[model samples]
Target: MINDNVFNGTFQNLSQKNMPFEQVFLNILQFMEKDPTGNFKLMFGTDSQVYSRETKFITGIVIQQERKGVWACFRKVILPRKMENLHERISYETTLTEEVVSLFTEDKKEQLIQIVLPNIYKGASLTIEGHIDIGSGERNKTRIFVKEMISRMNSIGLKAKIKPDSFVASCYANRFTK
Candidate 1:
């Protein structure tokens, strides 16, 4: 079980509200790298109308292999509305969780992370194949299955790809003792 206090939790909003563009973007990246094997929460910002695509992106759908590795399948939808302010940049962030993948505790988290991280994209086509209630509470939980905010967009009818350069531990360093 997660000790609860060790981790600094952040709020994930899924309402019709406005959020800091850079902050929200980092949140998605942190979320992905932390649980690479495959899990996510629907953190909503203002509608695509209010914000630009540069300020928004999605964590990949983490696919799981019954007895193998994990990765990410990331996605992005760049609309014309996005401002030129961030047009020079076109990459999604992904975090890698350190714990190894194993059984129920193993397969779903890291395995899922691996499958999805590698697949995230800004110009990809998506299809909301179905709906699932993953039970990740309002604050996002490591023990909880991923919670998705359904959306299926396309880049000329194809799913774009955000390839991983390498797996990063994503957080701070190793010297601190508990």
Candidate 2:
């Protein structure tokens, strides 16, 4: 129930169209330009289209909430022209938890395509299309979620890139100077 009102504003990066996983990830990451803190969780999908012999990738972000009740937000993509403070301070924390990476699982990836992607495209809004189901409490759910996250990470060799991070740090360090 978070960010649902503005969810339609977000859309997939056009450059990642029909690209391989490596390129897709690279492009999507840049397209996101997300603050590197506990601000958000990213979700993406690569959908195959046989007719054009291409794959389309769509990426969406859900804001991480810290309120008493569970909450998530789909943040609308802000057009660059609308950005009044490009040099504003953004979170620099790079620490990622298992739950963070697990959000990139295959199923979640697919769901992004089937469910979230269309919603994002329809109206230029960032929308969270799901509910927080904590009916049973966080006792066992947290543990189980962690286990599944670990398994998903094992399934996909996900890790931070030392080379790319350095390059981006250097490049974007001056992006807002103008």
Candidate 3:
């Protein structure tokens, strides 16, 4: 139920629509259960677009089992008015990502862990990441806020990724923001 109303309490993917967050969590579990021996990455990120009157933000949740398969979904949040401040927009995106991450509670995290725990000796594992749609390159305007955003993710104990590596935000979620 984490930030349930943010996306109107539903998420849509390739084959599903209006799926509740609980359902999405179950879907991730089922996907991992099918291949418990594989390495997994549970990632969350957000991207936004400002139209003339409102701003639309898309947050993507992805569970990828290394080279095997992936199950993903995204939620959208629309503001009543445009958000033109760069810092505000970027911070809000990170906050949205944090809300998604909060949905994976300790018990839920342990459930995902249990799936690969048995295969740990061999190589199975799970790593959660928060992808920020910003880069450190001098020419990138978002670079200025990279550290602040990464710090926010780290404060929540999530590994943070940016720019070229942050496909969840820069790529997946970005696709729906337009």
Candidate 4:
């Protein structure tokens, strides 16, 4: 069985503290309700860092209304020992992101989608994306695993994004993984 404690652990942003997963879901709904006419994107991503003794992983969940604003939060998971393998670390990050995404059940996603359906004619819509930290750049050590990671995200029905464009992972979650 999945551990509820880990999945429902506190998520925090600059303005919110120790919020349970349910509160985070409510906040996202409220944000969308405030401006249903705006285009929305719900994004999930993860980044990790290997310290001397352990590996720190930060998974970020963001809800963005195009050109307006965003509501985001992150949760951290740390492994007892450092994960030194490039492929293993990248794979673990993806797994963490997927675990969090699984918490947004079909019903929850439908609720978020329903909020924007009425505004669809006005060019408003909602899209879900999974951002993987790996990239295809020649010099990027994570290049080789991009396809595999993207495939993993796609398997769960998320539009997959990577590197430069995946700010949620390469930028946001990355900040806390340090």
Clashes of each: 36, 10, 0, 0
lDDT of model 4, residue 33: 97
Model 1 TM-score, 2 decimals? 0.21
lDDT values for all models: 0.26, 0.27, 0.92, 0.91
Give candidate 4's whole-model lDDT: 0.91
**Candidate 1 RMSD to the correct structure:** 18.6
Clashes of 4: 0
**Candidate 3 Cα misplacement greater than 4 A, ranges:** 1-6
The TM-score between candidate 3 and the true structure equals 0.95
- Stronger candidate by lDDT (3 vs 4): 3
- TM-scores of all predicted structures: 0.21, 0.21, 0.95, 0.94
**Residue range with the least summed lDDT across 10 consecutive positions in model 2:** 86-95
- 51-111: candidate 1 lDDT, tens digit per residue: 5333332222332222333332322323334433321211111110101111114343344
Question: Positional deviation of 96 in candidate 3, in angstroms?
Answer: 0.4
Candidate 2 lDDT for residue 139: 50
Sort every candidate by lDDT, greatest first: 3, 4, 2, 1
> Cα lDDT of model 2 overall?
0.27
Question: Which residue pairs of candidate 2 clash?
Answer: 6-125, 6-126, 7-125, 7-126, 7-127, 8-124, 8-125, 8-126, 9-124, 9-125
RMSD of 4: 1.9
Model 3 clash pairs are none
lDDT of 2 at 75: 15
